[model samples]
Target chain A: MKMAILVIAMLVFANQTLFEQLKEKCELSKNEYLIVIFQTPGNCVKCFIEPMDLVELIKKNSLGINYKLMALVSVEREIELKVFQKENDWKHYMLVDDGNARKDLGAKGIAMMIILDSRGKIMAEFLPNQYDKNIEKAKKFVKSR
Target chain B: MKIILITFVTLTLISSNCTMKTQHILEYKPEKLQTQNLNKINIEPKGIIEIEEDENNIIQQITSVAIIGESNTLALINGKDLLFYDNTTGKFIKKIEATFEMTDLVAKSGRKPYIDSNYERRKVEVPYISTTNYTQNGIDGEIAQQFIKNFFMSLKNINNTFYSFGTIYCYYIGSSEKSIDNIPVLFVLNDELNIESYVVMDLNKNSHAIAYDFYINNYIYLSAPGMYKVPAFGGEFDSYPTAAKYDLEGNFIKSVSHMTNNYLLKGGLKNGWVYPRFIEVNNHIMIVYPEELAVFGENKKLFDLQNLPFKNDSGFVYYQDYLRYCRSKEMRPDIDVIARLFPIKIIDAFENENKFYPIILVWDKNKPMGFYYLIQEYTSDGKLLREVALDDEPENQIRQFAFNKYDKELVLFKKSKTSWTAEKWSLR
Candidate 1:
């Protein structure tokens, strides 16, 4: 009984550590599977299309998992932000981030995605200039989990 | 110095003798070897060399060249002047002065005059009751017009043949008002650079005709788009894209013609026009809608894309991915809708043997670096064999090319820095 309790406590502590790390970097608190897409003002339009599609696909499938999705946009102007929102149809979860967020997040370029665990721990990240490859990687990551 | 000169002279004598035909050179060689050791003697034979004098200097002002007929005679164009040269010897032959004016034929096939606000054809008064503000600019319109008259324009070449056609614009002084007419004339030249015929095509007055190709059966393919609703005196006609088959002499062949059967207009959209050129493969005449679609044969069947991995889906995926990545990029929504339906533009297509080589351009959906072409090879049954990306630059211009059917050789004529080069390659 003591051994079993010790193993469970260790697992919980590891999960908490992962959650803390993800929260520190992504500001995601839902402690579930979260996909945060980073977009820059000068990013290619082709970059954001796949993430939007993945969001739609996940929603349609009703995957029984805690998922928090948000787009970190560099543009500050409300009108410009709305235009970007309207263009991408990002009505639900959109966060305005500092322009240096891409550099801070270690993102190679725009259209980069950071996948986080339920405990706010980084699971996997995909950074392909091509959105097709990025979406394929995201789909495969979800399937593997 | 004398001994060295003698040795040089002896070597020249030996080389000249060896270069002669076997019958002429036999006299200089002994019938049998006098020495027993044949290994000690080294025999060298100078091979036959055919020399062709370079004629590029003479044709410095030449604009284009077309290798015609079985003899491969070159038909060179310099403005309104057409010069002929022997393809192998590079010898200049003769130059012919030509004029492209279709005015006489267009006036003869006249239409009804304009009346009221409606576009109804009605008889109008030939003479005006009063004349005022009459102004004349030299012989034609102005000095600018005179300079424009001398400008030369060449249209697409007839497929697999050296023949090409051009439109001739002519103006006539009517009883009351002046009128302009467009006439299409065919230039048929043979192997000797002799002008076989300069026949004016007997087509409709309001319709514009573009000659696509002249086939083996003497059938000429022409794109006469939106010709059914003929225009009246520079009036805009709704495009009803259509291609027709005519004889070598440009007479409409109803039996095999795509125009008579409504092949070009069969596409659901009425305004979806096609480029003038057509490729003949596997006995079928094929025309590409360039990145959008390809239609061929008498039935106008769509070429199957069974071999392409993603096929149509790949194009949409690219657009969606591109549009999402660049948040600031702006594009008309209608273009997105069209792209969702049809994603590619077929740029240039050629045929080698039974295989088809299509060059396609896929847009990046954003400005700056907008487009790139994908050169692909496919079988007649539409099996994709190979694909490569061709980056486009402003300086590198692909002017013209010819393909050898038997050897599978492609000779691409590229123009750069006011000079042209013929590059030959074998298709893998």
Candidate 2:
């Protein structure tokens, strides 16, 4: 009975280790060319263009580059993202860090973009600017990589 | 038994820690407005001006009309013409041809007019005219008349473009494709249809398309949406609402980023919320939300919370009075309850005489629900004042409510689904 209990404990430990490994592997790190996207709850006519344009630009210029897009939104705004994705046919991974993202990223201003490298280093930060011009710069950066 | 006892004690302590303690203070409730025979009050239905007959006409299909002032005059744009209206008489006063269709108009009073006619005329210097013969003066006369005619036309255009001299100043922003870039040029027009000054508010290119001036304490608060960025979770864009303060001369005072701890829980930041309505009460600006209240106190510190005594669903924060009114949503099924199961819709707020209260109206299913009961709770201490219900209508919904300070009465505009005509009830 003691041997059986030991075996059960070993299995649980193995499962936990495997789960942690999976989480680490799947989760985005500070290093991997991370692009932080700040969005309001609804599809604002002009404000909604930044993310949609960025995704399209990235997809068009995806030349052997690894990048992850993260969304910082409110708790009340989750359903809006789903609707936006479904409507736009967007197939990008999303994270749900609402208020914390704003606090951590210092992104009190919406439509602000921050690009981080694989080393979790912020390489480029774009505050409120023309959407097309900023996206063009982001495209050039991705292309250079 | 010991384990169970310990578990219960632990649970109780955890629950107690989670609950926040709030102070409650008592205040007088205003007497309920008499509901005796609301039908007895004589109310004349204000005629609706059919701006256009075509279904495809944009201005005719106005989903909402936000009345900015109490004056009998209203400046309305139908995507084609800038229309002036006499509100009381429901008469179309005058139509001014605008260079571009504008969605909004801001009025500034007591602005001086400045005109520069030289800027209007582009004259080519006439070479020295040495007339040797006196018989060929007919051609010279025609040439001089033509020059004078062209000069006068140019002056007229300039006068129409930048001439203003009056107590009231109305500025209009014309539609332009260049709106995607710099701040749109605003043309100030006087009461006499003359253009005043073209004020260019040097707005950042990243600012949202819509902007408005909130007048408070002899100051104007200009609110604009900042840029949009992709969210961490991917997909849609998030918006940040940013604001700036400007003096009467259009001098930039300061730019403030309005940040809130509450954001979307799922993937992206809340980006699209714009047009924050400011309410000033006793030297305090109450940035009110349907659920939360952000009080810019006298100390200049911003206080925000959702811990008021009233339910979140039934309450609305009146920005002007710094009063939060909580009313029941009787008819709207889509409207969430106090727990925020749905979005809160505040129907109207009206005041009569010394007693000021906002009327809570909502739509449930096909029927309209009216929460005539009003309450005001302050944030400093949970001081509460319960006001009496003015009227009750289980079937008929109150579509609009207006308060006339001159008459010291609360006007309730009711719309019945059964009847074609709407009824108005005045509480004196």
Candidate 3:
């Protein structure tokens, strides 16, 4: 009974550590909230909206939120991405998730958005369209620095 | 100096990798290569292929074009719709709305009708059919069969041998027990758009190559692998065998043509520029970076290649590493545009009197870059037969140009003050 309880605690601690590392890697520990936009696999040319155009809104500062905006690009070319980031003066951070590392975390489908709290727990999740509907909700979570 | 020169010349036609073909590569003989005997020919404008204008200014340009049914050429604009125009007169034949079937099972609510007033194509939500489940490896022949029926471009399923269609499709293959497997599959649609066979082409997220301008002559010459794919139009030496000659039944024949990028790497280029055939004319260099076949010949051309590279005002850096004569940043815009330009050995092969004569369109260094093209026709043996100066008046500057092989005419997409129009010119 004692060994089983110990193993359970260790698993929980490991889960927390994974999230803590992700938060640190994304540099979101300094910020109160982070809104992550996950791109789908295999770029669909004729998708409902051009994925980059929707993501460009965050880069253009049109989102009007203090929350740290991030886009996870699922591409292998890091150098090309860096060149793009530097050339465009990409303000927000883009985590290259070529392996789909966050798939288990429920960030599934095309341009999926997920909001995480300071401690790394997912605070609020929005649909592809819900983020626009709940823009005020995202702003409310932004604790005053 | 001679030994190093011999090694470098031999490397140009060194051929492709494991998924490559060496059987059909033309034997290269540096000593026996032909000389330039090109007679100059005048470009005669036949007619204009007036592209139908979209008043709202949404359609940018024709992204993909294919010769369909001998008489017409199908143009895919902005990946939104397919517009058919007559090959001769450029008359509007018909237009089909390219629709998307939305199936985001994970983000259910996220898949709502995203209606934006500024742009209005986001409101569509067609039902996506999901049925494929991968159990075994190798080509999924059955799924390849289903893909043709799902091809959304045509108004209805093609009933006759009106066209030979080829599309690079991304299919999600995995069962409930397994994770989602993403692979790009190409099903060659021939004889009434029937998915008769399959070929394993890794034209995917990883490959720095693309094949679009393809012609079928028993074997599909789907734009040789070395196409103008990346932003640095001349990209890194990609190993993926995206270009190949395949029979109608999708049997691998030969990976016929390829430019050895490893040769550039050997020449101390780290991020290798997609430099076409190793040829130089005077101090000026030329390119063979077209859709297909940069006519393989002797490495004698590589010997004369002088590294005179030029940079433009728009931070447009051309020919980065291999041939390096930048000297320093002192290479300024005050220098003429011709000083900074390198010739791209363009591909549009010709046939006359039962003989194959490949056309090499060089950038007219005398005129400002992109304003004009110097069309140089060469015999199959690399003999420059004739050279014609494409009409390069500044007033009638063209935005884009293509040689319609079906009609045997050079179509120039001229950008006028009011709209973009295509002018077809005869090549004889």
Candidate 4:
């Protein structure tokens, strides 16, 4: 009886660890905001925003904002995401979603940025720009909090 | 280090499944090979016009032949150059050059010219009109020139122009620099080579530059793949093979989404890959692709292999690997069985009292000579009323053949393997 109880306890602990691993890998936490960057699959060069711009924006504010950047890579392409990350120096997480990602996020064009709050509710969206206008709005929201 | 390892694991998991799916679709084995017997006919040789031999030892040839016009006038195009054969025997004619590189030619029978201003504003720095005057038997050239001019101008006024009972139009997507500002312009040119109208299609979303192709009846199809931002091993984000349709005046008629919900709902949206070959058959507009067929109608199918009957050809199976490899290398395969298999290669169509007949010329891969099997009045039930074997000799190949509606005869254009001269044939 004691041995069976011990095995059951270990199994439950293992399951908990697996759940934690998934949450860590996906960075899915109530405190973190999920920013989805949507794009069309091919011949969409101009729609893409430089990763450096995003990184600079995040670093400059010192607002203690927690967020994750996800790139919705289309399935049609045989893209190597690691190679993409290394070459572009994209330090954020990326996800592979095909056309569904566009429909789900209500994104009609490429290089669209949507900000989801900690509760997974959409807070705001930004189009193709330097985010000068968006940055001020985000600062106000952070200050209000 | 742990984060890097996690990223590596995630990428490997994602990429492996994609590779597997792609391979599964492309790597199917063929059952067997089949051959069909074709007819052969010899065309009389005319004098050589030009010839050049490639390293592969294959000869490139061009020729001009005379047609029995009112005064021995013939129409022919040689290696992108248009020439006319006007003589006593209707044998040899002089070369006629036009201002623009001729994309297509339509002969207007006894039609007069008319002008329109709708085309004037959209005309770029290039000349809006390109025409020439030619006449036989010492007839005045002024009448012919005016007739051609008025025909093009009047055609510009027609909202929908039909060519040989089929509507035709051209659509253009402006350059990337202009598209970003929502000023992307699309030009619609009708069958009579007149600018029908223009429209500015805006990319409402933050999009990559606009890239598109046209469907029959003026459908502007757009395909922008999402992989552009991702830094991958490939050179650039090649355009996807997605499509949509527009009206003659560049109005967005309908947009086609590439995805559908299945039981598992597993697949992603399709991308536009190649220039779409649009054809109107049985009043149905069908867009042909190597892997998929897009039929416009109530019953829509997705990635359905059975809809593409030409894929069953054994010759296609034989060349499948080489073609796929060439496609991977960004090269076009020479023998496109899909395009050639369908009746799309039919050069001309004519209607009799009770039936519509299509004159089709098909390529036979097994034959040593590049002969084309000419079928007169080819029925959809696979019946050939008249079979003419064209280009039997190994030294000569039939480049193109068409029915001269004006002359009421079959016109065969033949070129020699070693010479530039092309021979003309008229079968009564």
* Interface alpha-carbon RMSD, every candidate: 22.4, 20.4, 17.9, 19.9
The DockQ of each candidate is 0.01, 0.01, 0.02, 0.01
Model 3: residues with Cα > 4 Å off, grouped in runs: A1-145, B1-38, B54-59, B64-80, B96-167, B171-210, B223-242, B261-263, B266-294, B297-341, B345-365, B368-371, B393-396, B399-408
> Tens digits of per-residue lDDT for model 3 on A1-145?
9999999988876675534645766777554567676643223432213333443444454344445766665544343344324323457777666544455454433325666667666765544444455454444444322
Point out the higher-scoring one by TM-score: 1 or 4.
Answer: 1
- Choose the strongest candidate by lDDT: 1
**Candidate 3 global CA lDDT score:** 0.41
Model 4, residue B202: distance off in Å is 21
Per-residue CA lDDT of candidate 4, range B223-272, in tens?
32221222211323322223445454434444342222220021222223
What overall lDDT goes with each candidate model? Answer: 0.47, 0.37, 0.41, 0.37
lDDT of 1 by residue, B168-225 (tens): 5544333435543344566666545555765555554223454433333447666654
Candidate ranking under DockQ, highest first, comes to 3, 2, 4, 1
Instruction: Please identify model 2 stretches exceeding 4 Å from their true place.
Output: A1-145, B1-71, B75-82, B96-98, B101-179, B182-198, B205-209, B227-241, B263-271, B290-340, B346-428
lDDT of 2 by residue, A1-145 (tens): 9999999988876665321322344475544566666654333334555555666677678777776766544433234345435323446655444444544543333335666665445566554546667777777777777
lDDT of 1: 0.47
Is model 1 an incorrect, acceptable, medium or high docking prediction?
incorrect
The ten-residue window of minimal lDDT in model 3 chain A covers: A40-49
Candidate 3 residue lDDT tens string, B124-228:
332122333223434354534333221222111122233323233333322212122221123344533344543433322223223343434445444333322
True contacts kept of each: 0.00, 0.00, 0.00, 0.00
